[model samples]
Target: MLLPYAKPPPGDADHALLPPRSVPARSRTGEGFYMVRLLKSALVLFIGLHALFYALQNIANIDAAHGALAYVLSGADHAAYPATMFFKTGNPLLAWAALAVVLAGELAVAFFGIKGGWDLFAARSGTAEEFHAAKRSGVIAAGLALLVWFGFFMSFGAAFFQMWQTPLGTGSMEGAFMYAMASAITMLFVSATDD
Candidate 1:
């Protein structure tokens, strides 16, 4: 059979696993790559460090922090909460457990996010293939950040703690959603392969 070009087409059986060009993920130097890399790195660090700071600050005063958490859990003066059984439980153990999970997640985000940013920075001078390969850390970091804000805070705080029922509770939800979206969008940007 005749061929369209000298080599097999990009999606053909012979080239399904190969790049059309020499380097698969490498991209030509351009403004878009730098912009995406910068934005992704900043977003990862921004959310990760912010969560770490929150966890660190709250650790010093567990009693006060749990007091606030309990307040949010109770839905404040709002009567629209699903139920109040958890509030009546009145166990510091549960609060401590929640605090521990959040703090751990925060630390993970901070560590992974920083590592991802460093990887990207170090690869800036290398080939686009190197930059693309270095993005693995950033991807993991961004995922952790999203999980911390959305999976942990939004789900646990709003569902378990009923944090979305009151002004302060709602405020927490808004912040969580914001961080989650920022991390998500940054992930999308960084995941884009450039020529």
Candidate 2:
């Protein structure tokens, strides 16, 4: 009597007999969405607070009949106006540059908050598949986040220069630190995600 035996298909035996390959599963939970939301909120709040502080400071100077720009420019020339060690009347261009840099940074922050919030909400509501399909692009969100971070760093330099030249009160210092923290946290979150 002859025994009949069947040969396994090529590659099938190798793949099937061997344990199935296990890939580390990625999470698509609401936790990630929540984290991004918190970060966005903090960024917006910080920008608003900082802008308000600056506005108040400028208002105070104007009300006091002291020329804010003159005070900023003429570092040590005006005895009534405090001298800023870093800024001098000769460096008017620097002051303007700093102002422009900060304005750009605030705008970038706003853009990020809007886009990130939209993405997070869509993802959390279980519409990620639809959202991803319509968008077919993470470029906008990623670009906004990058721009915000870049602008933040640029503004940090300008703010540092301003603080060195003019006295930034405790409130300003605290706000700056908070902004820095928020930026760092947002960057970390953006970098960790696949989308």
Candidate 3:
């Protein structure tokens, strides 16, 4: 039914019933599909490197990070609302634990992103099924990115710890939102099925 006008060119009944073999599946799909695979790889790699460098920076400035967490948890300048924080703490152990969780999450995202990006890049010239299979790691990275930024920073830090009260906290929340949006968009773009 695909090529009703085209005949099997002086062939037997079995051959005549089959679709034309001249046109390839690749020709029907075009090159844009391959370009999308490449874009997915590049975007994931960018997010991976961004997270990796941020983790490194956090390690380099451990004292600063710890201090920031301490200040946020202490609820120092939360004058906007009269409601008191239910879980305010100045313990170094708690702050350190929080920082560790963040670092671990970032490192995990970096690992998955880099690995997935490389897999996708390597499968660019492969069949569509191969490229689809290569997206597993990238999808995981994107999900972790959402968990880190939206779940940890925005929901936990901002809502629970009241991190949006201070100027520094507001800046951090905004940055987290931006990163979350980027990862969400990338996830959607990379997950779309192509024919």
Residue clash pairs of candidate 2: 73-89, 86-165
In terms of TM-score, which candidate is strongest? 3
Whole-model Cα lDDT of every candidate shown, in order: 0.72, 0.44, 0.86
User: Mind giving the per-residue lDDT tens digits that candidate 3 earns over 132-166?
Assistant: 89999999999999999999999988999888999
Give the residue spans of candidate 1 off by over 4 A. Answer: 1-32, 73-78, 82-88
- When 2 and 3 are scored with lDDT, the better candidate is 3
Candidate 2: segments with Cα more than 4 A from true spot: 1-93, 125-166, 169-173, 190-195
How far residue 10's Cα lies from its native spot in candidate 2, in Å, is: 36
Pairs that collide in candidate 1 are 27-195, 28-195
- Select the stronger candidate by TM-score from 1 and 2: 1
Q: Which of the two, 2 or 3, has more TM-score?
A: 3
Which tens-of-lDDT digit does each residue in 136-168 have in candidate 1?
A: 877887888888889977877777777777787
From the highest lDDT down, the ranking of the candidates is 3, 1, 2
Minimal lDDT window, size 10, model 2:
130-139
**How should the candidates be ordered by TM-score, best one leading?**
3, 1, 2
Q: How many residue pairs clash in each candidate?
A: 2, 2, 0
Q: lDDT for model 2, on a 0 to 1 scale?
A: 0.44
